[model samples]
Target: MKVRITIMPQAAVLDPAGVATAHALEHLGLHGVSSLRIGKLIELDIEGATEEELHQACRDLLSNPVMEDYCLEVIS
Candidate 1:
């Protein structure tokens, strides 16, 4: 099966890197954008797994539940 994980920082956390990139874009003449948030996408291909295993992957290793949120999509 193929799964895609989308991980993003919680609104309460400070995203320094995202802020820096937003500023860089402003320097490049890109304007009118008020905010920016950077996140990560992790795609995995696992053979024969149960639903519980998929959830465990994200909880145990793929993401940090403390500061980030994740959504799992099974592609195939």
Candidate 2:
């Protein structure tokens, strides 16, 4: 199966990179932006991992539970 994982910093966490990007966008004349955030995507092809195992990997290795949130999707 093919999977896509999206990971992002939790709202309560301060994201320096995201802030920088927002500033850059403002500089480029994109106005009226109320909020912005930065995140990452991971795509993988696996042989035999269960959904529960994938979620466990996300919690234990892919993302920091205290500071980040993640969503896993099976694409194919």
Candidate 3:
């Protein structure tokens, strides 16, 4: 099975990297780019794991609950 994990900053957390990227885009003449939030995507292959198992793995190790949120999707 293939597992995709998207890790993003929480809504209440500050994203300085995203802010910097937005500013850079504006500097490069890329207008109309309002708010931008940066995150990470982790793709991996799991052998003999169910959807429930993947979700549990995400909650337990892949994401930080304090300032991060994650979503898991199976692609296979």
Top candidate on TM-score is: 2
Ranking by TM-score: 2, 1, 3
Highest lDDT among the candidates is held by which one? 2
lDDT of 2 at 75: 100
How does model 2 score by TM-score? Answer: 0.95
lDDT of 3 by residue, 1-76 (tens): 7778999999899999999999999999999997899989999987987788778888888888889999888877
TM-score comparison, 1 vs 2, better candidate: 2
Instruction: Name the 10 consecutive residues with the lowest summed lDDT in model 2.
Output: 31-40
The collision pairs in model 1 are: none
TM-score of each: 0.92, 0.95, 0.90
- lDDT for model 3, on a 0 to 1 scale? 0.90
The per-model lDDT (C-alpha) reads: 0.90, 0.94, 0.90
Q: Name every residue pair that clashes in candidate 2.
A: none
| Model 2 vs truth, CA RMSD | 0.7
Candidate 3 TM-score over all chains jointly: 0.90
Ranking of all candidate structures by their lDDT, best first: 2, 1, 3
Q: List where candidate 3 sits over 4 angstroms from the true fold.
A: none
Model 1 misplacement above 4 A: none
